[model samples]
Target: MRKGADTMQRASDSRTKTIVVVTIGVLILLPAAYGFIEKLTLFILAVKRDLIAGFTIIPVVNYLIVTAGMACLLIWAVAHGMFRRIEQPKYTMLEREEEIDRLDASENRTGEDR
Candidate 1:
């Protein structure tokens, strides 16, 4: 029975670690992958160049960097929204305040607030 309980605890710990690692990996990789795909699509279409109408092709190479940056920002925003919905992050200011209040109340109860 003790062995079984220990095994169960270890399994639960392993599962939790897996979930945290996967969530972090997805958050980091999703944005990068999406940005790459969008940029590749833009290049393949060749429409952006025509739309910008030779403004991108300047002495300073401005359009290339700007377009790529915009694509990255767009992808990051989209992926961030998706991840936030799925992960339901726990670090809100209200939650933090509640936690602090609980800690303070407990300390006061124990006469440790002096």
Candidate 2:
């Protein structure tokens, strides 16, 4: 009886893992598949219309615009100190909290002495 229960639990766990993997795969692939299909459709339409030059130039322009935008964002982040001593802020916060607690404790001790 105990062996049968163990076998059933293992089967359930396997099924759950398979389902989770399938779900994650679908979530990741569905958007990528849709984008591919959309681009293919647009390329076919452009070819049909003989506007291949515009289609080619548009993708290049889009790539440039996206690159520039990302560069600007990165510059802004650096200018604002987003990447400066990333771990320092976390430790600083903890230290500040500890200092405040120490001050409060000292204040309480002084008050009791009076």
Candidate 3:
């Protein structure tokens, strides 16, 4: 029991450390990369003729990108929350009623020894 508790505690710490490292990497690295790319894009637009009227003239497209990004972020946040909330119980039991609902006696064998 103590060994199991120690292992679980170690696993929790590892998960938290991993999340912190990834969060820091994403939050800091992503914006820096985005800014660098955006600036480079602006530079390219300045040097090119077609870009003069690209997204600059269409405000909605930029807004769309922001909207899409926000939607994705919202989805990711929700999924992460759900995963954290249900982090326990690595295995699950399927009640026979539920399992039988998915089985066909003649077409498929219930594959479990009685």
Candidate 4:
């Protein structure tokens, strides 16, 4: 059926978009993550060998923890479909406002008639 075909096409498009997003995310994030990890490793080694103050590790560790937490939140949002329709909320709000305004006008007209 044409409907079935359209459904399949939509599903394929969704998959393609997801793949493209993930690929681009990886391309952008992978190198930065690798560089940060490398630096963190060096800092940790320096602290272990007493070449640097142990306190220096504090900031690095804190940064890593925060970054990981943020990354987890991003993944959670994506998995929960929060990113799927970023523009939809604005349109939905506008529609609801219009409906409410229409209802208010209708109520006002009825009240005037009574």
Computed on alpha carbons, the lDDT of every model, listed in order, comes to 0.76, 0.86, 0.72, 0.90
Candidate with maximal lDDT: 4
TM-score of each: 0.39, 0.44, 0.41, 0.72
lDDT value, residue 44 of candidate 4:
74
Query: Order of all candidates by TM-score, from best down to worst?
Result: 4, 2, 3, 1
Clashing pairs in 1: none
Instruction: List the lowest-lDDT window of 10 residues for candidate 1.
Output: 82-91
Candidate 1, superposed: residue stretches over 4 Å from native: 47-114
List model 2 lDDT by residue over 1-114, tens digit each.
999999999999989987998899799989988996798688667767886446586675687699789989999997998975679988999999999999999999999999
Ten consecutive residues with minimal summed lDDT in candidate 3?
85-94
Query: Candidate 1 lDDT, tens digit per residue, 1-114?
Result: 999999999999989987999999899999999997897577646646476644444633566678779979989987787544343455576688899999998988889645
For model 4, give the 10-residue run with minimal summed lDDT: 51-60
* Model 4 lDDT tens row, 1-114: 999999999999999998999999899999998997898788778888895488776787788799889989999997999977899999999999999999999999999999
Q: Give the TM-score comparing model 1 with the true structure, all chains together.
A: 0.39
Error of 1 at 26 (Å): 1.1
RMSD of each: 9.5, 10.6, 7.1, 2.7
Per-residue lDDT of 33 in model 4: 86
